[model samples]
Target: MHELAIAQSIVALAEQQAQNRHAAAIEEVELEIGVLAGVDVKALDFAMKSSVKGTLMENARIVRHDIAGEGRCGDCANVFPVNRLFENCPACGSYAVNILKGKELRMKSIVMATIGLQP
Candidate 1:
């Protein structure tokens, strides 16, 4: 699954960040996942857990923020909630819709453990 690759990438990034800060370990990782991002959350979670083994983030807490999908009608300028891509506009029933949100898969923040610091 691509989730495994994604997880590995995330781990690498976290490790890089921790090393850059001279951290002893990673304490937490905050992620933002959008509904329309096409990533399976459960699978990604499992992949992340597996990927962190023996890594700096092995004991880190993983926090995920699920962002809801939203879109704006290109024809009528109406904003509405969307579940998937290429959705027809609810107000004008047009296929020309511009996505306003919910296409994100990014790391929002990371908490690292400094040397001799109790977290």
Candidate 2:
């Protein structure tokens, strides 16, 4: 699954960061996912469990932050939710809308624990 490959990449990135900071293990990996990113959280979680088997992020928790889609109306200069993307603006019924948010997937933060450090 693509999630497996994605998770592997995430682990690799986190491990690299941990090593750079001299951390022992990854504590958490925070992600921001827009509604239009089409990422399956459950599948990603399952993939992460498998991908981190023996990596520095073996116990890292994946924290996903869901983002909503927004559309800006060209006619009315208003912004509103456009979950379906095909629907017109709820405020002004304008078909000439541009996406202001959504279709984004990014890693937000990586929390790591240093070797022999407690807290």
Worst 10 residues of 1 by lDDT: 110-119
Per-residue lDDT of 1-119 in model 1, one digit per residue for the tens? 98899999999999999999999999999999999999999999999989999999999999999999999998999999999999999878999999989999999999998997656
Score each candidate by Cα lDDT: 0.95, 0.85
Going through the candidates in the order shown, the clash numbers are 0, 0
Task: Tell me the tens digit of each residue's lDDT in model 2 across 1-119.
Answer: 87788888888888999999999889999988887667777898888898999998888888998888988899998888868566697887879998888767888999999887657
TM-score of each: 0.95, 0.83
Which RMSD values do the candidates have, in order? 1.8, 2.4
Q: Which residue pairs show collisions in model 1?
A: none
- Best by the lDDT measure: 1
Judging by TM-score against the true structure, name the best candidate: 1
lDDT of 2 at 7: 83
Cα lDDT over the full model 1: 0.95
